[model samples]
Target: MGFFSHTEKLPGNWPSRFHHKCTSKKCTYPNSPQAAEGRYVCLGKVNGSPCKGTYEVSPSDAKAAAGWISREVEREAEQSKKLMAHLQEARRRKDDEHLQLYQNELATYKRVLQADAEGDIRFIRQYIRDIDSVALFEPERWHTHLIHLREEVLRLQRLVRELQLKTMNT
Candidate 1:
């Protein structure tokens, strides 16, 4: 888990500044002679954890830094692939669950609407029977109440029909 530390390039393979600490707090000299001698610093973690460990390498020692960088890149790539696959599986499972929930809700709605429509029909039938009885035995008793009852029956019938239409469309 190593990477090349960001450094400003100076002339002849020298870095402008070293991430290493200096003894003097107000030291103006950033590029020490030892640090400037083709040294490449790895400002990366020692393991997966952020240790901030710095590994210094000379230009002549390419094998050390190259091996660390290559291995880290390979490991990260494999980890990313596994994570991507896991995410895709989770998304697919969630989608299936959501679809099942939607279907269950639709079925519940249909059952409720059908029950309501049947109840309305029963009420309309009872009202018709009452109206027939009144017309036959007490025609003089017919008033605004009878008209309102008739309108209510018609309204119930319309409501049931609308429910039926909605069910069919869905």
Candidate 2:
């Protein structure tokens, strides 16, 4: 009520006790000739003390108080709504940023794992080729060389499959 900026106006309708008076109390006027002749004093007490405020019963004063109070209430409500909307948007933006960062980290980890697996496969193929070349010159060791090569190839294939599955799961 104190924050409201009052303005002058003409007479208007008598809307009941929605506006605050001094100490939350309202004004009163007696049914007498003096009431029609003079201004009405607000009976509301301020800070536990009597209020000295007075206003005429004319339409101008009533309309002015009502209009000022209405505008202040509307302005405050709009400001509150805007503040809540801003907070919600900020939270949504932060959540999106965190999600993007997590996705980037996951992608980087998968790429490193894929590179390691490819390197392992490359080394296994080269080792198998080296053994085959030696076996061609030593015919007595051909069977043993093939068995060892097959075991190593099987192990490397299983390792590659496991790496693929790991990346897929995460």
Candidate 3:
């Protein structure tokens, strides 16, 4: 058994800044670069001996990485406010089905907002990277794409509800 025995290996060759510290005992190295085959190799020395220990690369400065996530949260909160208004309209119209759907979607939005606030560095970084790539490739269609995605989700939800109702009846 080892320190990383229960842990899965980390993928990719991330930069030194992304890595926090080495996990080897008594070897407080700052970063561990990936080997040729993608194993993290510690570059620390312990009492005149090469540490050469293998450890998972913990993320450095999660708060720093969460800056984009904070801005995204603000944007998502505004979107959720619109969703809340829609939910209110459904209530006013006494649309039970739509109200249920809106409640479910609002729950999902709250869960996502909670996750964003918790600041998962890897997820935040990947999300920012993906959004940046989309904006770069399809500058004009970015907002339209988001709108289409929301519509698609609503359509899918309705379809799923219809199927569930049919199944219950059958």
Candidate 4:
């Protein structure tokens, strides 16, 4: 597994796959006279594959490879986070035209979702107000529709925020 830095070794089981016998005389695993029979645990990649231990890497090479992988993972994480923040800000912006479109869509959604006689007259009034400029809509009624539209838009925005928060937490 890759990480942004040298991960703390987990305690109680500093384990590794069986590697080759150590060549260094100071190395305990290979100090036996029959060094070829000695066992080892791999701590690095080999033969262009991972977790299939069959090669021994120089300590220097393993450290370098680990560092490279760590930096790459960190870079990717930073980029992904920046992109998500931008998308979230764009989603939250309140543009009237976009809000109107969402209002129309919400009306349709309400009709499909609500299974009762409360078919939402508020939707029809708002829809008419948007399309008809000459129609003399009651001022109080029109104002109430605008207020309801704002409330509905806010509710949808909150739902989107909740979904985003849930995804990020996971």
TM-score of each: 0.39, 0.36, 0.24, 0.30
**Which scores better on lDDT, 1 or 4?**
4
Q: State each model's C-alpha RMSD to the native.
A: 15.9, 17.1, 25.6, 15.0
Per-residue lDDT tens digits for candidate 2, residues 5-47, read 2452212542333332322333331211121223555565567
- Candidate 3 similarity to native, TM-score: 0.24
Candidate rank order under lDDT: 3, 2, 4, 1
Error of 4 at 142 (Å): 15
Clashes of 1: 0
Top model number, lDDT: 3
- In model 2, the runs with Cα more than 4 Å from the true position are 1-59, 116-170
Best prediction by TM-score? 1
lDDT of 4: 0.47
User: Between 1 and 3, whose lDDT is larger?
Assistant: 3
* Candidate 4 lDDT by residue in tens digits, 1-170: 11112443322333322223333322222111111322335334334433333234445445655565567679999999999998866665534345556557666545523422355566555555565544335666545655665677568766655655654554
Task: Please write out the lDDT profile of model 3 over residues 1-170, one tens digit for every residue.
Answer: 11232253433453434343455657655552322223466766889898867655324334433544466679999999999998876655555565467557645544434445696556544544665665535646645644555676576567657645654553
